[model samples]
Target: MATAATSRGFTMPFNLRLRRADVATLNDKNGVLEMRRKKRRLLTSDWGVVKCCCSDSVVPIRMATGSGNNVEKCEDWRFDMKKSQNSQVVRAPAMRFASPQPRFISKQDKFFPRCSPRNSGPQSRDSPPKRDTGIANEKDWGISLLNENVNESGTNEDGSTWYRESGEDLGENGYRCRWTRMGGQSNDGTSEWKETWWEKSDWTGYKELGVEKSGRNAEGDSWWETWREVLHQDEWSNLARIERSAQKQAKSGTENAGWYENWWEKYDAKGWTEKGAHKYGRLNEQSWWEKWGEHYDGRGSVLKWTDKWAETELGTKWGDKWEEKFFAGIGSRQGETWHVSPRGERWSRTWGEEHFGNSKVHKYGKSTTGESWDIVVDEETYYEADPHYGWADVVGDSTQLLSIQPRERPHGIYPSLDFGSTPPTDEPPDESSTSQ
Candidate 1:
């Protein structure tokens, strides 16, 4: 009977398409219409237990109303199956539904084949196959089928897997795999896979674990394999003090006083040369002057000098006085003459005689001779023009003497006897001699 039934089951070719909105509306109704409509053909067909595959059509069903109205309503709708040529369509029972094939059983039975060697063993469908252990231990599962001559086992005591024949194992650090010409199955029995082995450092970012331990010793000091050591307690204390002082100084000012001090300290510590000091000094000076110098004048005075008398007195004491003499000017210090102009020109003898009765000529003679010169005023008793003279007599020839008198005639008279021109020569003494 099972054989006859299997022979009666035939594959049908059908396509199905349903609007999601229609399905949602059908679920809102009583839904009996959808069930009856989906099974209508199967219930009436000649086949005893007909099975149907859903195709392209809607099925509506009627549901009895919960209300006491004694009325039935459309409750829901579902997809329907269509009969294809040489095949019969049937729906499941009202409470039954179709389901997809079971997955766990199929996977457990190795229903799907795998292509990897690691998955090709007898227990491949159960757990992953244990890697080949012929090269070494189970942990040293290497590519032994490719290079039979190589000992593909990890070097460390942990016995980890390895695929390369040469070079040190990465050990606790996992081995680095890369393409090489040495291990794997190929056309040749002695085929080589693309893999290589190198020390951890041969690649990147691999460091070795140290055998000797590190850290402090019994006296709470670092192990003394070398002289290098950390800062001492006193050194740290000094640094703390310096840092606190700096912070205090910084907080005390609106400007960064501590920054400047620290910078200077650092600069000093670095042993700057004279040139560096000079350069920084100039920079600071210029900065200060620019910020503060605009209020003053070129001479740096913002206030005018007061107290006229005091200023005059100060001027007299510290400044030179300009004095205009008759024909010369002089700048004199306390008791000594600082500067003198050229000597005044002498008066012509004619003008001197006319203005001062010839006594002026005698005075000039006295001044030049530096000795007492007797001049006859009325004869008999002669008078000395000057008592002091000496050394003044050293004057050179009087031919170069300048005349101080004005021109005679229209220009001027009385004060001058025409000194600009030759004066009238005194009448020569009478040539006739008086008889004794």
Candidate 2:
């Protein structure tokens, strides 16, 4: 590659070619012409030659390096015949070449005003220093407080750093506790995130009442959920159970592909039964959540309700919260429903209430572009309450609400369960190795 250095010390590689036919000749001689007159022509004095043999006429000279790197033809570099003949010696502007060493060109060299005697004279000692308009200092932008409370830190064998912190305080019940472990690794652009939970427990033996655990993979494409009864007191029976599961699809041809379910049921020695369930999932561009809880006082009072909400890629949102309570002759039911449009230009709401034997309904709506309405209807009625309405009425023989059956693998939630003391590895384990 042939390289040419600019006056500014920058080198650029390019090919140059000049044919013999392109060379200029005077009196049948190339480059040098036999002196036939007193007049002379000068190309440049800086390159050493002041006078050239010949009549005072412009002679185009084609230059070719011995290495074959020749100059291209340019009209601007040639002298005019009239101008050369009228003057004793005509000289072209001196050409400058760059040094072999390379130099960096900064913005100040091209964009900023330069200091010279013509524009800017020498500064006086009494004058203030000029301000630099370059990058601003970090203090001017405000300091980050992320590492303010980092008490203990250390480097891992993998070259990543880890931090550990813990605190405790006395409270009305006993003492509150907190612990945290976090760090990151740059090997694969992977970060490790883990949180420590402080459960509400007595200072003596902070028994594991119940477990609430949740986690998501690095890609965020997969999620895991778990909830179980860890403290099985004598009041609870072996039948008491809880578990969770998750499902995920590969990235190819899949949209919003993830599902999670959680369920738990517990019974006390006093005969009070507690059961609840939660389920949610995504399909295509839409996602939804469903949850309902049930409680039996062991007498005749029972409460059951369902809460659900859903949103779509179109920005539309809707939800419902409804519940019903029944005893002997005293029964009450209430429900609320709402929906929102994609552009928030329109919305609708409907709600109703029932107590003993009276009921009322109210609804409000906002239409698109200058249209809206509000309505409320009150209905007075009396009817005999269902005295036999109870738990048996909702579930006949099975303890599990067949409709609320949750299915998934549990990633273990008990405090006693050993989730490795070491932080999660920076890289996710290979599937093949994990399966084995």
Candidate 3:
């Protein structure tokens, strides 16, 4: 290794080599050019310069051929040893080399193999094995074991909380009512004591008496003292009779038959009379049933207007009281029978024209009369008759019948009162007037 410093302030180590032919030129007068294996050239300078006598020496020569040839090759070569002394030596650049560190296997990785189901046997340490007990040995199981022991000990029979002492078994009820301690005192009180019978209603009275035998009294027997004595055969019979009377009364008033008997007997008793119908003047002036019946009957009357006679003769007042009352309001005159007016002359004429033709009168007595003898007329007929006796009497046969023939009238042509268009303009010339 060779170390040298450069002018650039860096030191480096490098290898050096010299050529065999340049060994003799090692003297310090002139510098030697050393060439090695066609790679690089190294120069060493000499301190001295030789003055030659021959001109050939002035011109340096280099051999161009042959392997053994050795000649100095230079062109105007000059050397300064003093300057060379100060020149720094050159060395090749240094390089840092690095590589990844090698790795070794750890102990844990080497000793323990990878876990796989195919390579390893079943796990023995992970979970404990399940045990099987015989069916007869049910005591080894969890909840089932406890239940079996409880059954065998007969604890479940009288309820789990109950326990009987030795030589003291459960009663016929399979339950213990009382528990006795080994040396406990007897239930009977010590020293003098008295016996007393009590009536529950008179607790203080019974307590004051030292001993008294209670017997049936006029007021009533106490239920707590003697329940059997309180209710006798006669008392039961009286209750039965009262219940029968109530049921009989309920059946009479309800239209529902016996359907509402229970509800009526229970809630409706106070509001009902002895006859069991709801009382009048209680919630209202009359019973609801009476009002309901009235409404039902009125509804039937309303439907009666659909009758054909009412619809045609009476118009909309068919089943109502309007037509009859109107007829009655028109008082009779002289010996003539009264008649009811049609709603109005316009209404009468419209209705009449719809049922009858325009013919005023004919041999058949007005074309408007149906086979049933009901009068019918047209707008012209009603207008002609309206001024005479009103439309009412005009349509009524009792007041004025239809003429057998057309007639003449003071107001143009009109239905006849007798046979012609007029009401007899010449009254047959009175007999007295003719004689005079």
Candidate 4:
């Protein structure tokens, strides 16, 4: 007797372990899929189990769901290294319904297969190339197969798995400072790198600047940043942080980047874990941002990151125009995040919102601008109104009401609702909402 395959549109679980080097995949006419590296397939179909042969290392079990044409293209997207894992488990607000077909019409119903972070995305301008071929190299920058410390995994404890590259790709002229290849992987995600810019005395190798991100064989121009990661365990948990740290760095970069990160994580006896991270960094004079983010959890994902900054004098006539934006969003739901401060002024320039689907229309004191715009003004007091919930006092007592007065927008300019938060409205406004 045999069991039926999981439903096509089912919420399949993902569990994977990709060892070093490149892996080759073999999909036969039969419903079976096979992958091999370094010429080995110790475990075959007769055993009714699939094993990723890492020399002598064992990776236990790997689970993936699909039938017929439902192969999942696993992807580890947009990461900043230090907090990559923070964005992993986010279940977007959109509903994801499983169905018999490979693709689902609703953004809410779409499904994706287990992704290979190897082909995940861009790490840098030019370093570890992305692999599309079925074969995985022992030098692949993926998670290790077995949590073993021996050379049994076919690659060196460090060299093969932990891939690192660095050089100065900032500044127009050669002065100093540097990019440090501080490496380490996030709790459940990709690698992270760093820069040693603040220190002037502790310089190493290349001492100048301006090195190409790709194919630049310059020295002291070692101004570069990169990262790596490793999975931690219990029995191995007793091995002192240092020993494990060494074992990890030998196989990852996060070990080096760890000294510069603040991680939030929880673990249990069964090895289940949850992790989130926050970090800040600067690269030359172009990028200035700080991020507080986390993903791949039970509920949803949250992210608050500053945008890349810019400022310049065009022909000296525009007179030093500059702009910056700050944004915050959570999960796949639309109309939930906000972006502010784009025009270099908070008072006159309005911030706008972008969501996935429909938006609610809240009742606000009409502005010279649209109903959505909220011009900054001196605070006296104000009541709030929602479509579902009737007009109510903002601070305390629900029955109490606050007075409202309109303030002038900068330069006597007309107000516009194109920017700023626009609360959604699917239901009716409070029976008879109040006005200014």
Evaluated with TM-score, which candidate comes out highest? 2
Off by over 4 Å in 1: 1-166, 169-182, 188-192, 197-199, 202-436
The model with the greatest lDDT is 2
Estimate TM-scores for all models: 0.10, 0.30, 0.08, 0.22
Expressed as tens digits, the lDDT of each residue in 310-329 for candidate 4 is 11111100000111111122
Give per-residue CA lDDT, model 1, range 1-436, as digits (tens).
0000011111111111211111111110111111011111111212223334222111112121211111222222221223211122111111111122323444533433211233222111111111100011111212112212334422222221223333233222232222112222222222111323211111112111111111221112111010000110112112100000010000101221110110000101111111000000011101100000001111212211100000011111110111100101111101001111123222111100111222221111222224323342321111211111111110110101111111122232211112234533212123121111
Position 236, candidate 1: lDDT: 17
TM-score of 2: 0.30
Q: What is the C-alpha lDDT of each candidate?
A: 0.16, 0.31, 0.15, 0.20
Residue 119 of model 3: what lDDT? 23
Model 4: CA > 4 A from native: 1-139, 142-220, 224-228, 233-287, 290-292, 295-436
The residue-level lDDT of candidate 4 at 385 comes to 11
Candidate 3 C-alpha lDDT tens digits along 405-431:
111123343222223344322111121
Candidate 1 structure lDDT: 0.16
